[model samples]
Target: MTNFDRITVDPTVMSGQPCIRGMRLTVRRVLEALATYSDRNELAQEYPELEDQDIKQALEYAAASLDDRVLELN
Candidate 1:
């Protein structure tokens, strides 16, 4: 699935931050959980509403965003 397919952005939700399937959870939140918890099963347990793919797709979206970037020196 594409990045936008699993992730959503709405002005009414989280101030338009990227969310999971229009839910209140943000990609940053999930990534933070992954960084701290460091266990997929534990994260799944913490946020029972999300599946493995949701977290996976969040990561995919972040990675894809970096893939399209260019850094410049002034």
Candidate 2:
């Protein structure tokens, strides 16, 4: 899914931070979990509602966002 489809910014959630599937979980939290964890199965176990694909999507979204750059015109 595209970042816009999977990630959402709502004033009621996490101060409008980009979140996954409109849930309270932020993209940063998902990325952090992936970074600190080795076993995908274990991670899934800890977050029963989230699957491996969710983590993958979060990474993809983060990567795509990193590619975005703001250019300054003089």
How many clashes (backbone atoms < 3 Å, residues ≥3 apart in a chain or on different chains) does model 1 have?
0
User: Which lDDT value does model 2 have at 54?
Assistant: 69
Could you say which candidate leads in lDDT? 1
> What's the alpha carbon RMSD for model 2?
3.7
lDDT of 1 at 69: 57
lDDT of 1: 0.87
Tens digit of lDDT per residue, candidate 1, span 1-74? 47368899999999999999999999999889889887778877899998878988998988877756578989
| After superposition, candidate 2 runs with Cα above 4 Å error | 1-3, 67-74
Specify the poorest-scoring 10-residue window by lDDT in model 2.
1-10
Error of 2 at 9 (Å): 1.2
Question: Model 2, 1-74: lDDT tens per residue?
Answer: 36456778899999999888888889999888878778888778877777656677788888887857899999
Candidate 1, run of 10 with poorest lDDT: 62-71
Highest-TM-score candidate? 1
